[model samples]
Target: MSISPVNCPNTDCYWSAHGIPDKYTEARAWHLAAHRAEEHGELLTAEQVAYATRAGHTLPNCARTAAAVAAAPEPIPARWDRTVILPEHPNGDLDGQTIVCCITDDGTKRPIGLFLDDEHREALGLLLVDPNGEDEEHATLLAEVQRLKTELAQAQEDIAFTERNTLPELRRTVEHHQDGKKRWRDRAQKAEARVAELEAERHTTNEALSDAAQQLRANSDRITELEAELTKYVGKEPTIAEEMEYLSGCLNAVRDLCDATEKQATRWEHPLPVPEWVETVRAATDGVRPDDPNDNRHRILVDGKGNGWISVCSDEGTEWVVPIQPAAHVEQDVRDVADETGSLREIGRCW
Candidate 1:
């Protein structure tokens, strides 16, 4: 089925400025009209006007009125009830008259020139030109020329429409895509920078952890050496007297070594650490005397079991003795005070 092409009511529209041909489809006509309304400020339909109004867009005065007229149906011509009269040609030649006709709904002949204005009459005259005594081939060539002219005009109109309506929208679309791409690129650059920063931080942290691990290993080795030295000093349990004797020998050996090194003009760079047991023996033996009857004097003494005693004696015999509990070793300062004062008062105070 053939579709009737819709003519846009806006006389200023591109489609209306150009004539609609038989080949112009209904869909194409509406599409062009819609384009003209949107891009050219010439609304051709009632719906477009209403939409523009609701969207708070002001349309041109000409377009606002044209939309309503476009929505209304085309007026139907009144039927001719009386007999028609033919007008005389100005040239006074009936044979040369160019008559335009139309077939009504009832299949009766009607003069189309009655409805046309001067401009349309001139257009109809061109179309109705008589091909007097012209060959069939010449007529065919003329028809082809007319058809080509119509097609060329249609092509020019299509090009103009595209340039006016579609090109700007395409450019805007391209710009929008470019902006999106730029934003994404900026985000990517930031992400890359952040990743590099984190990587640098991780590298520094790894170096610190490696240094700590090396230091820990060195500390572990020092601890192991200290444990070995401790074990060598106190490998087995011994009596207090034997332990004291052994520490005394070690002290004499260290003193002899120092004396020999000094005599030879030698130096020792790193000295050995003194064992803790040496301090224990020194505390136990401080202000204590050896067992000797020949040297009769008042003194403090320590036994093998770490017990203490105060031996007070006259030139003739031992007078009094005070026993002290184990581990209560006497301080050398208190003994020196007792000896200097010729009294046991300081010693008693200490006890």
Candidate 2:
């Protein structure tokens, strides 16, 4: 098929230079109608409007379109001859015998009149006489096939575009999502481990607390025992340090008292006033001057009447009291000793 360039005479029309018109006159006539419809609102001829008004029928165009049609020139008619090559007959001997006539728009034929025999010519006349329906069917099928081929090419382009531009980006998006998922999984695992560790630490802390509570109870019981023992033995409650110090002090005081008593017994003395007679007897008797002057018998016996006496023996085996002067020096010495040992009374607290 050959394509001819069909253009609108009006450069302002949308179809002015676009190459889609199949026939020149048809495209030109359409553009002229479009111009009249747009610029003048003229679609019907004056005669058509009058006829519609008389018949009471509605028409789509105004009567002014008849003037546009009057100004536009009529398109020149052209003859178009469409041909199809028929297939050869399967019987090669009869291949050249068939004849096909050229089909016209009105379903008529003008034969080229080429014939090899009268028999073939008669057969073609009969066959080709059928009003061009077969030719139209063939053209319709050819147009359908062309449209399908164009659709197939467009589908292939779409497939190529998807493979080149869309698929890789989708793959990368999936990979990115997978990586994010992996990172979240790792974080979750770490969190789980941290939770377990905290639980274990809490358990250990609980055990330690249990042990401390037990030890506190034991300490409380021990304190109670110590307090009881203090009340039982010492007849009073006292702190252990205070009781130990008090007992140690008492032991020291008793030791001091014992030493004082031993010293006083070894050196017997008195700090009271001595009578004159007791001193006279001590000074007069040479034989009475004993080796130990601290003896109880040698100590002077003084009466409350300021008189002194010495125990004596007579020839009749009777005891006699003789008047004597007491020694004043020995009395003073005993007074000093008694004063030094006076703190012995404090030992009574031990009871």
Candidate 3:
């Protein structure tokens, strides 16, 4: 199908009904969350508010979403809404990862499993480590680091020299003038003023040196780390660079975006009311389907014991169920809801 410039990138959006609207919904939400996350200058995981459940907005949206799974006639429930609890990371340095989670209508955990990102596939390519590749890159960066270190050392020396020679001379002059008789009072005042000016310059110079020193250390460590990892991988497997390029080509092909856009646009499109037929298609079928995933079905008086049962299914299939109640008893409330949603008949059929 022709995807507009705006499209929801989530997999659920691939369903026929949502595909048309996915672009607007996905792009809008993505941009909104991304805009807020830009302040942190990092990617927001599901734990972040950007992707975490906004129950007020999300619950209602899911209720209306069409389940148009591809080529499947039985509309297996399609939902992205799920509660996820991540395991603690062993090292505090790494953040816990976001995992794909799903709760079945029956309130069971079913995770989405499959590798969608092709680069993660081991078949794409092997890590290429030429025995000599690391040696060359390591030598180059190490040489640059040494040159920077030398420059930093020189800057430090110049700063120290100025402090030792200039500061000490200024201090002695100021003290001498103050200790001398009245003739030297003016000279002492001038000498102390000069010392203050010199001290300010020294403070600024010290700060620059400190900053440069940190940058130099960081550069040196980075070079060393890169060299070590590269060397470790050498000759152990196919070259990583070679494998990466091959994988990239395979990814471009799987994308298969081609010209499907025009195909979808060609279809007649309009709002189809949430069909009451969907109820028959989806309603609980007992142990045949289990009264409801939520199992909320209860007994009350339509007039007396066993007269009523209600199966009001919600997002998490609670069943809205009543069990083992004989027809002698009645639930009046069940009658009210059955009169409303037409589920009371299903209860009568249960016996």
Local accuracy by lDDT, each model: 0.54, 0.49, 0.43
Candidate 2 lDDT by residue in tens digits, 281-314: 4333212342342433423433323233444432
Global fold similarity of model 1 (TM-score): 0.32
Candidates' RMSD to native:
19.0, 25.7, 64.9
Can you write out model 1's per-residue Cα lDDT over 113-205, one digit (the tens) per residue? 334444544543433344243667556766887998789757755665565346546767899999999999999999999999999999999
Winner by lDDT between candidate 3 and candidate 1: 1
**Candidate 3 displacement at residue 113 in angstroms:** 99
In order of appearance, the predictions have TM-scores of: 0.32, 0.28, 0.17
Give candidate 1 misplaced runs (Cα > 4 Å): 1-174, 243-306, 310-323, 326-351
Give the residue spans of candidate 2 off by over 4 A: 1-153, 223-351
The collision pairs in model 2 are 276-325, 277-324, 277-325, 278-324, 278-325, 278-326, 279-325, 279-326, 280-325
lDDT of 3 by residue, 1-351 (tens): 453333334545421121223434643354334333322233344433333355212211111112223333763353445333233434312233433344445455555522213333222112111223446565665577688878875665455435423543566689887667655777888899999999999999999999999999999999999999899888788654455446434433433322233334444476334434333433322112444435444422121222334443333423343433455333234435446643333423321
Candidate 1: worst-modelled 10 consecutive residues by lDDT: 342-351
